[model samples]
Target chain A: MSEAIAPALLAPGRTAGMNWRRLVPLLLVAPLVLFMLALYALPVLAMLSRSLLEPAPTLAHYAELAGDEVFHRIFTNTLWTTLVVTAGTLVLGYPVAMGLARARTLLPLLLIIVLLPFWTSVLVRSYAWMVLLGRHGLVNEALLAMGMLDRPLRILNTPLAVHIAMVHILLPYMILPIANALRQIDPSLARAAAGLGAGPWAVFRQVTLPLSMPGVMAGILLVFVLSLGFYITPALVGGPRDMTLSMLIAQRVEQLDWAYAATLSAVLLATALVIIAIFQRAFGVGTAFRMSAR
Target chain B: MTLAGRGASVALNSLEKRYEGFGAVRGVSIDIRSGEFLTLLGPSGSGKTTTLMMIAGFETPSAGDIAIDGRSVVALPAHRRNIGMVFQNYALFPHLTVAENIGFPLKQRGVAKAERARLVEEALELVRLPGYGTRQPRQLSGGQQQRVALARAIVFKPRLLLMDEPLGALDKQLRESLQLEMRRLHADLGITFIYVTHDQEEALTMSDRIAVMHEGRVAQIGPPEELYDRPENRFVAAFIGESNFLPATVRGREEGHVVAECAGSLVRATCTTNPAPGESVTLAARPERLRFVDGGWPAPPPANRLAVTVTEAVFVGERCRYVLRTGDGTSLVLKEPSSAATRRRVAGETAEVAWSVADTILV
Candidate 1:
């Protein structure tokens, strides 16, 4: 009995060694996992805790959020402005994406041009927009020179300026993914549709558009999410009345109200996650990631 | 099947297609009668597919006229040409079901809802895929997808149907089955079919008449048996079926036949095309037309005979093929059915191979 049991015990030890070999990779990855848990997840959890339990576990923040008119107006304004900026980016980016995808010789140059602004620091780009959109800027001077305006126009520190800068900065993010998706679609499919008796417009509407939806969805999600957390451009160009959630959180932090700022940051993170979850449920997350990565 | 051949003819008079400086198809002309199954058989780059595409109005002809029922349709678009086409890849829309793909043309023509459903069901049943109407193209097998393409092409019942190697994607057994089904469909529907293929066996098996193309020109056009029996030239002779060619000089002409001398041997062959006496020509004969004759066997009177050594022999299930070499080192392949046992000869043995003058075609 002892001799038989000895081999069985040795077999378990051999199996344990095999399992240890298999898990070596996980052991190697454990450091990065712990770093992310400490640097990213811990701060997020701490913010969430502050949002719920700050000021001796009172519900004052929730009560204030419901009753405050300024917060309500800012929330509505932020949501609508983000939506408008996202829609504007899509409208302006789609044609450029089409051109980039179809143009044979100039596609790389065009892609670089689209991505030129993204390579620069965001604050620097915001400053460049400020110089261009100010009352005494190149645009106002040109309009005045062309007799289209009687004087320098009041363009800076306005919602319009902020929107222009945001769209300019984010358009490439939308266009690149959309162009990648478009390029993957076979041109023969469109010709086949035409041969089957569909006109050009009908072919595009029925085939090209639906087939490129994965790209469009990706562009939309990207532009919307990026617009939600925009800070530098809005702060530099937008008026005080055009303050967004990021600016509000920064202002709270500057006044040394860490608990309030943490609450606001938690709200922003939760809102972004909820929107992403909704999109993922509608269009599969795997497909969305595939499109954007392509 | 009321086939109005005379009134509904498809004619391409000197049609030419040029791309940039290169001529893909130059000066091709043919007349296909309505309801005739005409196949354009050629090797790759012979411009067979270009000719079909020109007929279907996909590629605009750089020169000449294409007419349907006596009306020139040179400038007509593909949709307005009133023709149906089946592509090589099947080209089924992946998003649409089989029923929707079949019903597309009817829907474009604005057929009513009830009639469209009935017609879709009928087309599905015609392709023997009645219950697969709701399945997408990606869900079906390759052969089933090809049948869906066929149903889509014929669902509208167009006057002319063009197929560009439609069964080229299927395996051998499936391709043969589809070829027979297509022939039966053509006979029942009485629609003109213009098929393009590089497969000689397929053309011989299914075509009412075959147009053998070479270098953008119709080398020869005739019924299957006619083209096989009496080819007009060397190209046509070698293209249609397996034939052995021996370079010979015409010695004399009798009636329409020619007496020729090939490789220090005298032979008699019938001239399908006019070749002057004393002119060098190729004597072509089908492999199956020759037979191994025993030493004491009676000769085929008034036929050409030659004594040769069998260099190689192989049994191919139903038949035995022998490679026989003449005295001048010209090898001839002879095929005989396995049932003939008296004339069986082993390799390296000399035997008399005899074939009738009528079986010989002087090209």
Candidate 2:
């Protein structure tokens, strides 16, 4: 009796020959898919099409972007800043991630601190950094008061200020993924390694570090991708010359040069996509989603 | 594969692990002889795993010292102690291939790469897996993963190998097979194996000496046969196998055994310590040891007899288990082989159950 009922119970739609049941899961997301197509996909496609179609269908804007020395310098500076910020967040984030994974009692408190940055607006945080990094601001004032600096230093409008603020803002993106990865590791693996004659450093290097690589990769990808599109943080805290691709695109849009802005935006989007594709191919992008979703 | 004379004698002296207001392992001290397979067996919260962890150096004892080969190792870290350990879950590194996982310890010890490969291959062969070097951990089944974990632990050639319920996650058939394989491996390597498991049968099947634990302490430790035949206390008797306990008062001594009174009859039982006359004691006897005595056969002279009413009789394939009640209402189970020679008794039938004095123990 159980066997006879099991088939229908297991796949009632199949017994009824209702093929539409298979699409039910996909149908659940139909509304969100349509929403994305209208709000995000259509806008991106239209903007990308404008880069080629506007002012006569030509690749001249792309050619100019590739050949322009100023564009070259700005792109290089943006890459450098993104790399710096990625490394900065990683260096500052790993220990905290480890702490988050290990500290049972302090986990809730540590998690709050890590996620505290997300509660505030990015624009507000950038302005706050400007206040802190500005000449005679809190940092300089503290430095002067401690007699560490002879005078107020030119911290604002420099690459360092942008890096500091960006790292501070993007740290959670790096930390959460790493913490999730670390937490996923079975605690017995370390004990097993140690029992097999691995010392403390050896256990960390051989087991802990290797096991946490997924989170490390996830964090690096998230932080690197987010750092590329940063406009407000770089614009407010960066020096006049430390212009990123986003700020340059904003500058073109400000001058009503929509075609050039579209071209730059398209190129930046393509670069980010290429990086994400490479990351997805090398290390599963699902890990990033899983870790950061927590 | 030719691991012989490589075992280290381990002595845990008054080992204790306490947390907050309670003790996890309180005063567990077992002297494991070289090359002996000693299993700490008990149910959960019996401190068996905790005791194994302390011996492995993953857990620090609240007091007392651990010595390997007469050298105190309380100050040494887990790695420096050079003990191979296998966790219950087969804790193989997920990122590493089978060969890399096996060679991890050798790599840490700075063994040359070529030597590492050679050792890894030999270890794989030792665990009966060959040419499985590149297979990922997730690709393997639970039994295969456990084999890889065993290979990885033994590849380092640590003098002591600690296994924490390595077959706990396996099915019954697989667990039984692995238990035999572990026994074979222990005999082959002669490595001092400190195993921990909650399964009494697994411990009985594999160990040279079994330490039955209860309530964070060792209830009894002896050879399997000795522990089964002569359990020192009530916990050991109850935990090792099925036992029927009857409340009795010590009456007198007879033929080097203690005679006790239970349910208006005299029961002679072997005791580790002499109990004074009129002292209340419990007599433990195995179900299979009790037999029905009838008028056709002469009742054995040295056998202790009890008059009982057969309340329930169950015909289990090989044996008939009869639940009998004595005059005083104390219940007992008597197992009789289902042979054509012996007549089966039904409910409400009056009978005399007799068992040899040696089969009963005073606890």
- Cα error, candidate 2, residue A219 (Å): 1.5
Clashing pairs in 1: none
Candidate 2 wrong stretches, greater than 4 Å: A1-18, A287-294, B295-302
| Interface RMSD over true interface Cα atoms for each candidate | 2.0, 0.9
Best by lDDT: 2
Instruction: Kindly report, for each predicted structure in the order presented, the TM-score of its chain A compared with the true chain A.
Output: 0.89, 0.92
Give lDDT tens digits, candidate 2, residues B92-197: 9988999999999898889999999999999888888899999999899999999999999889888899999999999999999888888888888889999999
TM-scores, all models, native as reference? 0.87, 0.95
* Model 1 vs truth, CA RMSD: 4.7
Worst 10 residues of 1 chain A by lDDT: A3-12
TM-score of chain B of each: 0.94, 0.96
DockQ score for model 2, please?
0.82
Clash numbers, per candidate: 0, 1
